[model samples]
Target: MSAITLGAVRPRFRPRRISPARWGLYAFILITALYFLLPLYVMIVTSLKPMAEIRQGHLLALPASPSLAAWVKAWTSACTGLTCEGIRTGFFNSLRILLPSVVISIVVGSLTGYALSLWRVRGANILFGAMMIVAFIPYQVFIYPLVRVFSFTGLGQSLATIVTIHTIFGLPTMTLLFRNYFASLPVELFKAARIDGAGFYQIYARIMMPMATPMIVVAVILQTTGIWNDFILGLVFAGRDNLPMTVQLNNIVNSTQGERAYNVDMAATLLTALLPLVIYFGSGRWFVRGIAAGAVKG
Candidate 1:
């Protein structure tokens, strides 16, 4: 007969329960969130209120007589200078500048980053250093020189010139972002692609780009916000016929000759903010992953 020994089972580990410190941390985070959200709340409430109620100085209070008249005026009838065409023209003009600028900037930046990360080229480090230095310089410093160059080229203040300016300004950061992201990827893949006799563009098109979706989302978010909120560049390079919504909104709110309409100003601001807000909200998971992945090895 064989004797069998029974073995005692070990207990599974359990996570510790939340302590008072943890609860305090949660409370702090919630309070900070609310603090930041208060201004947005005020803006929304003010935009909804009529001018009559606005004059009463109740900023945080809900509107007693809420109406969309201000919104309507901002979108269709607000005067900027001699034009009463609202912000529609500016909106279209922004699109014209934004679309081409975003596309060209991203494409150029991605390619530049890719080459710097993967390919060996002479003076690459020096070129990249120059770009980084340019990135830190104040944008205003370049305005006069860029204006002169544009004027000399006969481009002056056209859509093309503005697009070029955006592309130039956007390059360094965008290149750095993609470069860091690509550097984080496995070198084995590039080697394997090269072993198969794949050219630079072939490898980029087939492998590198497909793996860069997250970084692309991040780049889009950054560029979209910067370009959309840019007042000075648009004012200088976009000309009168190509003024963006920011310029139009500024003109409407800051005109020295007219009585300020608080409700309309707020409404226009909210509207102007809508697109970037939409982009940020819609970016969702990709934005987080992109930043995480890019920063991991940078």
Candidate 2:
């Protein structure tokens, strides 16, 4: 009989089975997703339902007869004041404010963040701490003071004034974002640039800015959302001619007289919200990465 020698046998690879904990996690995620999506579902279906069907009081049910009339009315013929010109005017006005405000705020914030992170200037810490404290204070508290200051400067209730207001309010948060992101970078890079005789602007323009693509996207998303959806600030600062879509949306929905067109109201609300939703979704990947990078060190 041949002697059978015990030899090493490699274990076959087997796929791991899902644990109960993982299944529970999946269930929890599905529940949370449904919760968040509930409102959006309601808004969409409500917008599609006609005034007749809506009057039947079947809110949760799918529209028996879907119609695009509400969307058409909200976009082209909704009355806000004597003008029946829909939300188009306000849309253009918002774009004018949004473009300039986003550009100026991001530029100023990036510079401020860069200085605070890289330079050890006198009173920098005190200034940054003061800014942080200001951020915690409600924006409503600044309205009166800001109005007074704007009136004193003769910039009251105009495009420029609104843009300035957005910039001012956006600064602290933006600075903190970029500052933390910069702080997470390698110190060696700065030292190497310094060894090459690069000054502040040179180092920033060539090195820092180039490496800050993700954070810039993040800043854009934040400023766009806040500045776009701002009803109070726009109403206060964006003069009559410059009223944003949100203000127009409010006028359409909050009328005290005449039959309330719920369908049109919902459509207008969704349309006003579409811009921010687009920005959020478009920059979703960058937003996550930027936030992660910013939060890494500080």
Question: Candidate 1 lDDT, tens digit per residue, 1-298?
Answer: 0111112244687449888988998899999999999887887888888888889868899988789888888888888878888777778888888989888998999999999999988998898888887777887799999999999999999999999999988888888888877988999999999999999999888999899987787788777777888999999998889999899888887872756788888888888888977876797655454444434323
Candidate 2 deviates by what RMSD?
9.8
Off by over 4 Å in 2: 1-32, 288-298
Per-candidate Cα lDDT values, in order, are 0.83, 0.84
Model 2 TM-score on a 0 to 1 scale: 0.85
Q: What is the lDDT for 149 in model 1?
A: 95
User: Model 1 off-target regions past 4 Å?
Assistant: 1-31, 285-298
Q: Which ten residues in a row have the lowest lDDT in candidate 2?
A: 1-10
Please, what are the lDDT tens digits per residue for candidate 2 over residues 1-298?
0111112244787448888887898899999999999888888899999998889868788988788899889889888867888887888999999999999999899999999998888998898888887887877888988899998999888999999999998888789888877888998999899999999999999999999987788788778887899999999988999999999889877862678888888888899999988876887666455444333323
Candidate that scores best on lDDT: 2
